[model samples]
Target: MAIIKLSAIERRRLSAFITCLVVAILAWVFTALSNPYKFTVKQIISFKNAPQKRAFHPLQSDTVNTIVQGSGWQMLFSRMNDDKKVIEVDLHTLENRNYVVLSSQLKQINFKKQINNEIIAVNPDTLFFDFSSRRVKKVPVKLITLLKYQKQFAQSAPVSIKPAFVTISGPAEILSKIDSWETDSVVLNGLNESYNARVKLRPSTEGNLEVLPKSVMVNIPVDEFTEKTLEIPVKLINNHNYYDVKIFPQKVKVTFTTSLTKYPDTNEDVFEAVADLDKWKLGGYSVLPVKLTHIPSYSKIVKVEPRNIDFIVKK
Candidate 1:
């Protein structure tokens, strides 16, 4: 090539352009030496639904050292503003997956920019939770009544807990209310003779509920006291027709106590007094019967103080 020479101004212009290129190259080298990009891995703790899009907060608050690889200019641009490349996460995904690992290369990151409080209150404060196996339980029934009989006596009727069953329904949490139920006890110790009384059926524990067949009729068994004195006629047994045997006492006095309700309208003829002469000859004798001489009419023998009496026979 032929030798070509340039003017002074051209030479100075060329020198200036070379100087600028060298400065640019040195600047590029310097940027490459300095770290401008960063890569980080963080743990996702929890997530919340937001009405509006917002950033996330990291679990750690301290700055973490991370390695980033990029062009000098690109790395420098990232360092200027570290927030643009942060990953966005959804609440549903977090809740479903339960855990997530976020790996990213950035200039710098902040934990505060990753989190925001723009959450919406889609769920109510009180939730109505339902259980699939919820079931109904039956409660028992109780009965209460009063009973009266003839004057001077009172008692409780054979009270029967009818249908003895109850039913209750509610949430599983509330079903425990049916553990126990009871009826009131009847008091009839003070009644005299016979009486007719009324009874009330009420819940042992007052509550906002009802019992089936709330009322019942009761028939109390009772007795009345009645005093009676009866004269029993004595009859001789096993006496031969030829031998005329006579009882010294023609009549025997007997007294008895019984319930008037049971003894009402009973006749005195129901009682009898008898004498045994199987071992005696035709003669006059006095003997007391060892057994009861009479049976009370329509009444049970509670006691007999003197069962026998002296008997004298004459032939």
Candidate 2:
């Protein structure tokens, strides 16, 4: 090619193009350096198989730091591709150093892939945890029974529970604080006879707790009872006008049912039956006075059989 010199205008144009290209390259490098790529670390902690009596708080001392570095574009693309990238961790990796603290820290720290898409690896490999002391406690239990019976039937006494206590075990902080426990109340309204039932234990207070022997067997002592009969005095209201007529069977018989322990002795005349004749008229009429013959201090009547009676009078 023959030697051709560039005109002034052509030289100026070439210079401007070179400067633009250099500026573009410099901008790209600066941008890349400003923002770097990042990755996520995921890990799972393990513990020995043991009965979980109560909920536990994990230890935090042995967490392994996980660090990931990449180009900004690479990190962004990784996060977008797969948010849930699984990271495998070996339990054996956690050797020594407060296991409780490590375990606690592992639990507290939640790791997941960045929303953008990224590759992540959990550092230190294993999670740490602590095995602490636990104990079982014997707690006093109270039983209650709820019963429903026919209208004529009534519950005679308070329901009784057998072996009124149970054993409970859990974390020391939880077990030590609990003083006592109770069961649901037993219903005894309109109960004619005795009954047997099973009740469950309920915690009297709230906290981290575990109850052993969740249920208890309750023995309710109930029996059909009979009441003694007593004869009561009769008062005839119309008897004054019918002086010529005589009344027969002037006394009334009253009977009720009660417990054997509450039965009155033969020598004790604690009950009486009476008849009321306050509104009796004279002409071949019979009148009787009403009276309450039987009364006990400590016992309750199950049923008052034939509570009332009549008397006959003549004019």
| RMSD (CA, angstroms), candidate 1 | 31.1
TM-score of each: 0.29, 0.33
Top TM-score: which candidate number? 2
- lDDT per residue for candidate 2 within 215-275, as digits (tens), equals 7777665544556665545444434454553445555454555656555562236655444
For model 1, the superposed segments whose C-alpha errors exceed 4 Å read 1-188, 193-220, 238-243, 261-264, 278-286, 297-315
Off by over 4 Å in 2: 1-132, 145-152, 184-190, 203-208, 223-257, 260-315
Error of 2 at 243 (Å): 50
* Per-residue accuracy of model 1 over 9-87 as CA lDDT, tens digit each: 9999999999999999998788675643433322222223511221222333222232334445544554676453322
**How many residue-pair clashes does candidate 2 contain?**
45
RMSD of each: 31.1, 18.7
lDDT values for all models: 0.46, 0.53
